[model samples]
Target: MFYLTVDILGTISFAISGVLVAMDKKLDVFGVFIIAFVTAVGGGTLRDILIGNTPVGWMQDPIYVFVIFGAVIFGILFRKRLKYFRKSLFLFDTIGIGLYTMVGVEKGLSAGLLPIMCIALGTMTASFGGVIRDILCNEIPVIFRKEIYATACILGGASYFLLRKLPIEDIYAYIGAILIVIGIRLFAVVFKVSLPNIYKVEQ
Candidate 1:
């Protein structure tokens, strides 16, 4: 139940993120759909692969595909609503990170991975979709540029790992961990928190 909640939240958020970027890029309908697809599935795909789960997630659950496409149709019909979409997109994106991070960690533990590896999976599951979407769209991935994007997922996953050791119930623990992640991301956005540029050192 906890996992499902987080998964759906992330899915919707990332889907909106894709739509916004597509609109900004002036992509055609097909391009929008492609971006939507990539953003929605990219993280989960990486998570599944790292855990050695053959055939991956969406293949087992066609509903995931439907959900993403459903969002695409929504975006297409309501493209003018882009202004209104921004807040929802951010909310969903933050919530999704929390949810996906928790789910990723659980999957990792179930797969018998090390704690560090699970954290990596959690972060990947939360942020990789946006990465792929941005890359395909010829823009910077949100996770790479800072704004506490992947860091939120990282902290959320780690928090889950730590909180699970407490006396709290699993559901409460999970939600708590997710809240920690979402809260951080939202806080970062509200505060305009961002990492310093490292490109200056590239030369």
Candidate 2:
């Protein structure tokens, strides 16, 4: 049930995200579809392969494919209403990160992975697809330099595990994780919060 919700949200967010980027590039219908597919499935595909989940998650669950297509169509049709592209990206990315991170942690826990690996798993689940999408698009990924992106996912995953160890139920833990990710992201964006640039340091 929880996984179902995350799948829907993650696919929708990624599809919209990909479409918005496509629109920026003036991509045609086929181009939009390809971008949406990569953004929506890349991360989950990587995570599944790393975890040795045969057939991969999206391959086994056909609904996710349909959902991505539907989301892309909806994004195209409503592209005008989604006038504020940057705002939409921020909002959906925040949500997508939260949902993806939570489910990744859950999957890791189910697989009996340690908490540290779960943190890595959660980050991969939330951000790697965007990484791949950007790479394919011949650009740097936004999260690589922008706001408190991937770190928010990682921190929220760690926080979720910590909270779960307490008396909280699984649902509450999920909610807490989502909220923390969202809060951190929004706060970072609004306040211009950013991580240190290790590479740009003086030689």
Candidate 3:
């Protein structure tokens, strides 16, 4: 149930995020839906393929497709109002990554992967959709920027393993890990903090 909830919410959030970018680019309806669909499912598709989950998650379950359609419709209907709520959209995106990271980590563990591989899978699941979205929209993917984007996913995945060592229920640990990702992301955005650039060329 928890996984289902996370999957739906993350799908909707990413779909809407892609819609916003598509609208900003003045894309047509077909283009908008295409962008939204890929943004919502691309990461999970890649993760499932890497883990040898045949047909992928979205292919096996059509709920993700329906959710993205709903999100695209909602975005289009509320386009004007949504322009004023970019922060809210960002919040949803942050929450999406947090929740999806946990879902991905669980999938990895179920696939008999090691802890480190699980963490990498979790991070990939959380960030690659945004990467695809940005690429399609002709922008630099946030994951490649100096912002603490994908790093939050990694921290959350690490937290999942760390919390598992405790005596609490696994769900609690999962929720705590999600909170860590969201909190770190929110903190970075609120404080305008980003990772420093490591390379500079003198002209």
Candidate 4:
């Protein structure tokens, strides 16, 4: 039940993020839906394929598609309001990635993967959708840039692993992981924290 809720919320959040990006790019209705759908499911699809899960996740459950459609409609209807709350949209995207990181870690554990692999999977699941969306929008992938994006996912996955070793219940551990990812992202954004760029050429 927890997993399902997180998955649904994450999908909706990513879908809305995609809608905002599409609108910013002045994409058509079909293009908006396409970007929304891909942004919502691309990460999970890649994760499932890497884990050898046949049919992928969104394909197995049509609810994901419906959620994306609903999110697109909401974005279209409330675009003006959304424009005033771009930061809120970013918050939603952050929460989506946090929840997605947890889901990915759990799925990786179920797949008998190692801790490091699980963390990698979690990061990929949390960030790959945005990568796909950016590519489609002709922008650089945010995850690849000097931002605390994938690093947050990695930290969240690591925190989940550490918390599982404690005496607390698994639910608490999951919540902690989610909070860590979201909090890190929020803190980074608020403080303008970013990874140092190492590839600067002489101007």
Say which prediction, candidate 1 or candidate 2, comes out ahead on TM-score: 1
**Cα misplacement distance, residue 198 of candidate 1 (Å):** 2.6
Candidate 1: the clashing residue pairs are: 10-96
Sorted by lDDT (best first), the order is 4, 3, 2, 1
Expressed as tens digits, the lDDT of each residue in 1-203 for candidate 1 is 75676577678668877988888899998898889888988888988986789799989988788888888898788878767868877787777888888878888989999888888998888889989998998977767766788888888878887888999998888889889998998888889998777996677
Give the alpha-carbon lDDT of every model.
0.83, 0.84, 0.88, 0.90
Pairs that collide, model 4: none
Question: RMSD in angstroms, all models?
Answer: 2.1, 2.3, 1.9, 1.9
For candidate 2, the lDDT comes to 0.84
Count of backbone collisions within predicted model 2:
0
lDDT of 2 by residue, 51-89 (tens): 998799888878888998998888999889876665766
TM-score of each: 0.91, 0.88, 0.91, 0.91
Please give, for residues 72-92, the per-residue lDDT of candidate 4 as tens digits.
Answer: 999899888986867766777
